[model samples]
Target: MIKSQVGRRYSKAIFDIAEEKNQVKEIYEMLNSAMVLYRTDKEFKNFIRNPLIENEQKKAVLTEIFGKDSSENLNILLYILDKGRINCIKYIVAEYLKIYYRKNRILDVKATFTKELSEEQRTKLINKLSQKTGKEINLEVKVDKSILGGGIIKIGDKIIDGSIRRELDNWKKS
Candidate 1:
């Protein structure tokens, strides 16, 4: 909880700077790319999280990795590293994206089904969710075989489970 609070503070600072410079979208993309790398690249993640790594070395490495695509605001990486908060980068990025999506009046909804959804199905779901939430929906669809059938939709704190497995369990209880 403390770490998340700290991450939120840092994310808010970065979000403010991005907003001031009218680069919120760009910064969000950059942070998202960094988060993806942090999650998928074991070597890179270790390099960043290693306590033995000097801050200067980490800064140099970040510059080398992201220098071509990133802007001056990438210096935030150096600041985070210097402050020994490099481990919180993922949380910071997540917070930053939450703020960005809210500012854009977009809600990211995750939908899990037993199989892949067709394009038509996806569009219909997105439209329905947008109408219900009064916000543009960014849908992320995942296949969860455990759901057995039907689908489950999650929008922020609300979850709607319509899976057949859930229905069967409730029926059994009754």
Candidate 2:
């Protein structure tokens, strides 16, 4: 909980700087890339979380990985490391993206279906969701065979379940 609070503060600071320099989009992409790397690369994740490794070494590795990116964003990475808040990088990035999406009036929606959705289906779903939510939709689709058929859509704390399994359960209850 405390870590998240700290992350929020750091993200807000970075967002403010990015917003001022008109580089919010670039910085967001950088942070998102970093977060993806951190999540997908076990060795890199362990390396960053290792306390035995010196801050300089971590900073060097970070520079090598994202050096070509914005200097301001790089400085923020260094600043967080210097402050011993490196462990909270994931939360910081997540919070930063939340701010970015909110600023742009984009709603992040997760949808699960029994099978893959084609381009037309995805577009129709996104358009329908956008209209329902009154915000631009950033859809993340996943396949869940357990759903049996149909799909489920989640936005924030609310979930709309349209799966055949759910329908069967409702029928049983009735």
Candidate 3:
């Protein structure tokens, strides 16, 4: 099977455990923190990715770092280590966050505008998106002067391009 498929399976299994224990938010936070560490700490990243290092040693280090916080976190770490899926930690965390956000009725929307939006404009956009999707909007705003005017909003697979550039292109096509 593909690496992402493996990660998804493990993510689902871990999500089920977290849901069962009413710790979805906690687990999500833990996994996110671990992912940051994995990405930022070169030594830690190398240690986790090293095949020559014993899993027991990895488990001990992970335990010292995260075990004090939650057994569920440690269990997932140990489980992945034992299964030799430690390298898929990034995929696991991404898929887990997808599951968590879906369960929490949250949508991550990326909006690109010609300039920064005012607080009122940001809130209005978020409110509009929230009402449209029936989910809470977590808006990530960006400034792209190439858009010329208006803005482009991206939600999952959907893209709403209301920028002046797009309008001009459409008019030219006509």
Candidate 4:
């Protein structure tokens, strides 16, 4: 099977268990924390990916990292290690987060403007987006002076390009 398929399958299994136990948020937090470590800590990432390290050793290390009480998170880690699919941990976390966010009605959005938004502008934008999408918005803001003015909002696959650069381009075309 493909690597991503492995990720999807394992994530789905873990997510199903989390949903049944009403611990979806907790599991997501634990797994996401692990992913963050795997992403940012070079030593930890290498240790987990090293084939010479025994699975038992890896399990113990992961258990230590994730805490003994995090059974759901530890079980997923052990299972993945036992199956020698540790390389797909990143994809598993990514897929699991997709499931968790969808289940929780959360939307990840990115907004870019020429300058920083004032507190009122930020609040109003979030409120309007939440009302329009009916999902709690997780907004990430960026500043790009080249946009000149106005802003651009990106929600999932859709891009709302209201930047002044876009407007100027349209005028030039006309």
Most accurate candidate by TM-score = 3
Off by over 4 Å in 3: 172-174
Ranking by lDDT: 2, 3, 4, 1
Question: What's the CA error at residue 173 for candidate 4, in Å?
Answer: 3.1
Q: TM-score for each prediction?
A: 0.89, 0.88, 0.91, 0.89
**RMSD per prediction, one decimal?**
1.9, 1.9, 1.7, 1.9
Question: Candidate 2's C-alpha lDDT?
Answer: 0.90
Q: Which parts of model 1 are misplaced by more than 4 Å?
A: none
Give a tens-digit lDDT track for model 3, residues 1-174: 587898799899999998998888788777777778888999999998898998889989988888766886678778887998877888999899888888889999999999999999999999988999999999999999988899899999999999999999999999
- Candidate 4: pairs in clash: none
Please give, for residues 105-129, the per-residue lDDT of candidate 1 as tens digits: 9999999999999999999999988
lDDT against the true structure, each candidate: 0.86, 0.90, 0.88, 0.87
Total clashes for model 4: 0
User: Candidate 4 on 1-174: residue-level lDDT in tens?
Assistant: 587787889899999988888878788777777778888999998998898888788888988878744676578667877898777878888888887788889999999999998999999999999999999999999999999999999999999999989999999999
Task: Please list all clashing residue pairs in model 3, or write none if there are none.
Answer: none
Q: What number of backbone clashes does candidate 2 have, counting pairs of residues 3 or more apart or in separate chains?
A: 0
Comparing candidate 1 with candidate 2, which one achieves the higher lDDT?
A: 2
